[model samples]
Target chain A: MNPFPASDYIVAAFFLFCIATTVGGAFVAILTARVIRSVCGLMICCVGLAGLYFFLNSPFLALMEILIYIGAVCVTIVFAVMLAEPDEPPSGQNHGPGVLWGVVALVVSAAICWGLSQLSLRGPWVAPAARVNDGSIKAIGVSLLTTYSMAFELISLVLLVAIVGALVIARTGRTKP
Target chain B: MSLPEPFRLLSFLVGVMAFVGFNAAYLVWVERKSAARFQRRPGPTEVGYAGLLQPIADGIKLLSKQLIVPPGADRILFMVAPLMVMIPAMISLVVLPFGGSLMARDINVGLLMMFAFGSINVMSIMLSGWSSRNKYAIISAARIVSQDVAYEIPMLLVVITLLMITGTMNLNEIVQQQEGWFWHWNLFRLNVNPLMPLTFLIFFTCMLAEINRAPFDMAEAESELVAGAFTEYAGMGFGVFFVAEYANIVVGCSFATVLFLGGWQSPFGLWSGVWWFLLKMYALVFTVIWVRWTFPRTQFYNLLNLSWQLLIPASLFTLILVAAMMKFL
Candidate 1:
C-alpha cells in the first residue's frame, strides 16, 4: 500500500497530526464553555475525521464529511449560536442533582466507550473477498440510483419534511408587516 | 533536468501561492478601475501608470500598519479568521483546472473538493463576525450565513445537473466535455437541455451571491452595518479579508467558467489554451465588477427571496429536466 516507501514517514506524520487534531478538538468541544468555540472545535474534529476518511481510501466520503459537517452542519450550528445565547450556563451553582447527573453522564459515556472499544477489538474485521465495483464515483452513482434509490429518495424526503418543519417553526408568530 | 518529487511539489505550491497573491492584489486594482469607469471617474491614477502599482502601494501600506485587536474581541479566533478565509480559497485553487495542463492537482473529486473548501469561506466569515463581538458584525454574520445557505442549494443543483450531463465530477473532464466551438459549451448545449441558458443564469446568479458580490453584498453593507462583519479588523487583518474576497471572486468566476462556459476552449475552434481560460474567467470577473457598480445593494430579505423563491426552483427544474432528458433521450 505504500506507493512511495520513503514518504511513508510523512504520511504517518500526517496521520498522527489528524489523530491529534480529532482528539484535541473533541476535548475542546466538550470542555469549552463558549458555544461558538465549541462549534469551532467540532469543525476541527470534522476536518480531522475527513483526513482519516482520506486515509481509508474513501476521498469521496472525506470530502463529503468536510462539505456537510464543517461547511453546512457546523456553520448552521454557529448561526444558531449567533441567534441564541452564545455561552454555556456557568457551572458551580448547582449542588446535588447536577453532580449526580454529571456522574450519570460520565458512567454512561464510559460504558458506551468501553463497549465500543471492546466490540471493535473483538469483531470480525475482515475485508470482503471481492468487490462488486471499483467503488469509483460512477459506481457510487449507479448504486445510489439503482440499488439504494429507495433509501436515497426516502432520506431526501425526510430532509425536505425536516426543512418544511423548520420553516414552519421559525415562521410562527411573525406578523405580516 | 527534472526536479525531485519534493522540489516539484514545493515549486507547484509556490506557483499557486504567487498566482493567488497576484490575482488578489491586481483584481482589487481591476475592480477599482472598472468601478470608477462605471461611475465616470478616473480611479487610482496617482500611484503608478494609471495606478498599475496601486495594489503594491496598498500592500505596502497594509503591511506597515498596525494589526489592532478590538478590546473584548476573541483574540485567537479574530486573528485566525482572516487566515481561515484565505487558506480555504487558496486550497480550492489547487483543484482549479486553469488549462488543459495547468492545474496543480487533478483529483478525481476536484469539483467537490473545490466546493467543499468554498463552504469554509462562509464559516470563516461567520467566525470573523462572531469573534468581533460587535452587534452590527453579528447581525451581518447572520445575514451572510443565511444568504450563503440559500444560494448554495441552487448553485449545487445547477452543478448536479452538469454532473449528470457529463457523468464526472472532475473539473477537467467537465471542461473537456465542452471542448470545440462555443456552441458545444454547456451554456449553449440547447439540444441536451433547452433551458441551458437559464441554467447558466441561475449558476451565475448563485456564484455572485456565493462570493458576496453586489447586489448580494449584505455581508458588508457599510451604510447599515458599518463595514459589516469585518468592522473590528484593522490593517493587515482587514487587508487579508479583502484579498481573500477578490481571490474568492476569481475562484467563483473560474468555477462558473469551468462549469458553464467552455473553459480554455477557443470559441473559434482553432488555437486553445490557458489564455482562453484566463480570458473567459476575467470576462466573468469584469461582469461581477460591472454588476457591483451598476446595481445598488439589494434589500437583504429580497436577496434571500431571490434565491429561495426564484433561483432554487429554477435550478431544481433544470436539474430534473436534465435528468429526464438524459434518461430518456
Candidate 2:
C-alpha cells in the first residue's frame, strides 16, 4: 500500500492543471493569428501562473500577479485596443514567407524553453543547511533599513526617472497635435 | 491517528479551492459596498440581507449572459483571455498564510517564485491588446508595459528591503518573527527608531502604485480609455476580469498585512493574531477602494511621472537613510 494518501493525487492533479493552463495559454498567446485571441491566451497564462504561485507558497505574489496584471495591465491594454488600430492590414496570400517566419519564431522559442527547462530540471540545487532565520516581515524590515538600503534607494530613483521620462515623452507628442 | 500524506494533500487542495471560490465572491461584495459608500450611494441593498446575495445574483447573471465575440476578432483568444486573468489570481493564493499553520507550502525561494510568476501579467495584457485587433487595445497594452516597468522597480526595492531584514523569503517565517503586541509589528516601532515609519510609508505607497489603484488607475480610465484593455471583453470574459481585479486587491491587502502589519499577530495582544491580520488587510483594501472612488483619474503622463519622479526618489532617499542609520546608529 502506498503511504501517500489519495489527497496527494488531488494536489498533483491541481498542479498538472496549473501547468497545462500556463503552457496552453502561452501557446495560444504566441501561436494564434488573431492578436485579441493572443491577449486572451496571455490572460489565461497569467491565471495559471497565479495558481502556481499559490502552490509555491507566496499568496502575496499570487495576488499581485492577478491585481497588477489582470486588473490594471490587462484592462489598460484593452483600452489601448479601443483607441489604437491593431488589426493587421489585409494583403494578398503570402503563405510561403509567413510560414518561414512562423517556423523560425517557433524554433527559437522552443529551443530556449527546452534549454531552460532542462537546465532547471537537471541542475544541482543546493539545499540550505538549517535555515538561519525565518524570513518574517520583521526580518525583511530590519534588513531593508540596513543591508539592502542602497538598492532600495536606487529603485526609488529609477521610479522617479521613469515618471519624469514618461511625462516628457507623452507630452512632447501632444504639443504638435 | 496518523493521517496519510495523500489525504492531507487532498484536503489542502480542497481547502484552497474553497478559499479561492469564496474569496472571489466575498471580494465582489466588498468592492461594491466599498465603492457605494465612497460614492455616497446605497450599493446592492436589495439582494439577501443588505445585498449579501448580490454576488450570487451577479454570478448568475454572468453565467446566463451570452459569451459574444466581435466579428473579425480572433475567436480563440477572445474566448481564452479571461481565463488567463483569472487562473493566476486563484493560483497565487497558495503561499498565503491564513494563520500560523495555514499555508500550502513553505518553499525556500518563495519570494523569487512569486515575482517570476507575477511578471507574466504584463505579457498577458500585451497579448490581449494585440489579439483584439483594436487600436485602443494596442495603446492600452503599450501603456501597461510602460507603467508596469516603471512601478515594478520601486516595488521590488521595497520587497528587497524586507528580504534583507528577514534574511529569508518564507512568508510564514516572516510573520512568525513579529510576535507579541503592536510594537512588534514591523510598521510601528522598529528597534525604537523613528525612521522606521518612513520605511513603512514608502513600502505602503509603493504597494498602492504596484496594484495600480488611484491615483494610479490610468490604465482603465473609463472617461479617457473606455474600459481600457478590456474593451473587447464581454459577458463572462468581462466577469473573469472583474473577479480577478478584486482578487488582486485581496492579494495586495494581504501582502501589506504580511509585510508591515505583522501577519497574523494581534494588535492588542488579547485576540488571536489572525483576526488582527484580517482586520488590517481589509482595512488596507478599504483604503484602496476609498482612494479609487475619491480621486479623479490621473492623466497617463502624470501617472508615469509620479512613479519616476516622486516615488522612486523618495524610496531611494529612504533606502540611503536606512542604510546610514544602520551603519551609524
Candidate 3:
C-alpha cells in the first residue's frame, strides 16, 4: 500500500531529527573543552543540515553539503588540528570570566534563534501568481544567457578574485617558514 | 495534493532509511574498487570476487571492533561526531532527482536551502577538531575551514551561472529543458560554438574541486595530515564519516549528470531517461576516481591559485562570450 498519507508525519519527524542533531552537535561543539569532540559535534551538525537540504528539494546541495563539508571541510580542519596546537589548556583559576562568556554566548544565540523562528513561522508569505518557467536545467541555461548575464559574468570575476586572494594570503605565510 | 497522514509518514521513513543504508554500503564498494584500479592493485578481490561482498565484510568487522574513546576526549561529543558527518550526507539525497518525477519534495527555495544547510558542515568539523583534544585534529579543522572558504566562492559562482541560464532554481525543470539528444545537453554547444563547450569544461573542473578529489584533497593527504580530522576516530564513528564521503561522491556525480549531461534524458531516442542519467553519472564518478589516482596532489597555495587565476578568469571570459553570442551572433 502507498505510504503517502504518512508523509507529513515523516517530514515532521525528519525535520525534528535534523534540528536535534544540529543543535545538539552545536552544543557539544561549543561547550566541550576537548577540541576533537567539538569537531565531531560539527560533523554531526553538518549531517543534520544535509538532511534538511534533502527535505528542501535540492539533492545536489545535500550532496555538496556532505562532500564539501564532511569530506573536504572536516578533513581540512583535522589537518589544521595536526599542524597547530588547538586544545584548550586546562583552566585553573579563571572560572568567573569563563562562565560570564558562556552566559553571553548562550543568551545571544538563544535570542537570535527565537527571533528567526518567530519571523519565519509568523511572517506572511505570498505565493507567486503563475510560475514563469519550469525552473529546469534547460530553463536555467536559457535565463543565464538571456536575463541574468551580467550577474553571471560578475560571479566569474568574483571567483577569479577569490582564487587570487586565497593564493596570495596562503603564499605570504609560507616564506617565513 | 492532500493525502492520508500515516501512509505518507511510513513511506518517508522507509525511504530515508533504505536510501541511507544503500548509499552507505554501495559507495564504500565503489570507492574501494575505484581506488584499487587507480593504484594498479586488485581491491577487495578475495571478498565476493572483486569485492562485491567486501562492504558486508567491512560492516561486520567494524561492528565487531571495539570503539575506543580516548581518555581525554569529551565522551558525548566524540560519540556524536560521525553521526554529524553522516546525517547530512544521507539527508541531502532527498532533493536529488533520480528521475524527473522521483523527488522527495520540490521546494521553491531549494537552492538557498542547500547553501544554508551546507554552511553548518564546517562548524561540525571545527567542533570535532576542538573537542578531540588532539593536536593533529585541531589543525585539520582549521585547514578544512580555510579550504572551504577558498573553494566555496568559486563553486557558488559556477552555480549562479547555471541559475542565470535556466532562470529557475528547480533541478527537475533544468533537466527537462535539456530533453532530446546529446547536443541538447547544456554541457555541449547547441550551435557548434566554442563558448558553451568551454563553459562546460569550467563547470566540470569546478565540480571536481568542490568534491575535493585529488589535486584538491590537500585536507586529507595521508602523508601530510596523517588522516586529517579523522585521526582519532575508530569503529562506527569512523564508519559514519567514510559513508558520508562516498554518499557525497554519488551526490556530486548526480549533480554533474543533471547540470551538464542531461539528467535522466536519453542520449539517443531509443532508450529511456533513467538509464542515460545513470550512465552519465557513473561516467563522471569514474572520471573523478581516475583523476584522483592519476594526478599528484597540488600544493595548497597552487590549488587556490588555480581556481582564482585559471578557472575564474576563463569562466568570466566565457560568460562575456555567451552574452555576446546571445545578443547579436
Off by over 4 Å in 3: A1-177, B1-13, B16-20, B38-40, B189-194, B319-329
How does the DockQ of candidate 2 come out? Answer: 0.14
Q: Rank the candidates by TM-score, best first.
A: 1, 2, 3
Candidate 1 stretches with Cα past 4 Å from truth are A1-5, A86-93, A127-132, A146-154, A157-161, A171-177, B1-4
* TM-score between candidate 2 chain A and the true chain A: 0.72
The CAPRI-style docking tier of model 1 reads medium
Q: lDDT per residue, candidate 2, B82-178, as tens digits? A: 6666655555566777788766766655555555545555555555655665667766767776787778777777666666566677778778877
Model 3 TM-score relative to the real fold: 0.70
Clashes of 1: 0
What local lDDT does model 3 show for residue B42?
Answer: 80
* Per-residue lDDT of candidate 3, residues B68-172 (tens digit): 888887667677667666655555555666776666756654554454445445555555655576777766666666666666666666666666566666677
Off by over 4 Å in 2: A5-177, B1-3, B192-194, B327-329
**Cα lDDT of model 2 by residue, A1-177, tens digit:** 346646578788999999999999899888766455565677778879988977876655575676566655665565555455556655566788889998999899899999999998999976533433554556556777899999989998998998899899889878764
Count: clashes, candidate 2 = 72
Ranking by DockQ: 1, 3, 2
Evaluation by DockQ, superior candidate among 1 and 3:
1
Error of 1 at B279 (Å): 1.0
Q: After superposition, how far is residue A145 of candidate 3 from its true place, in Å?
A: 19
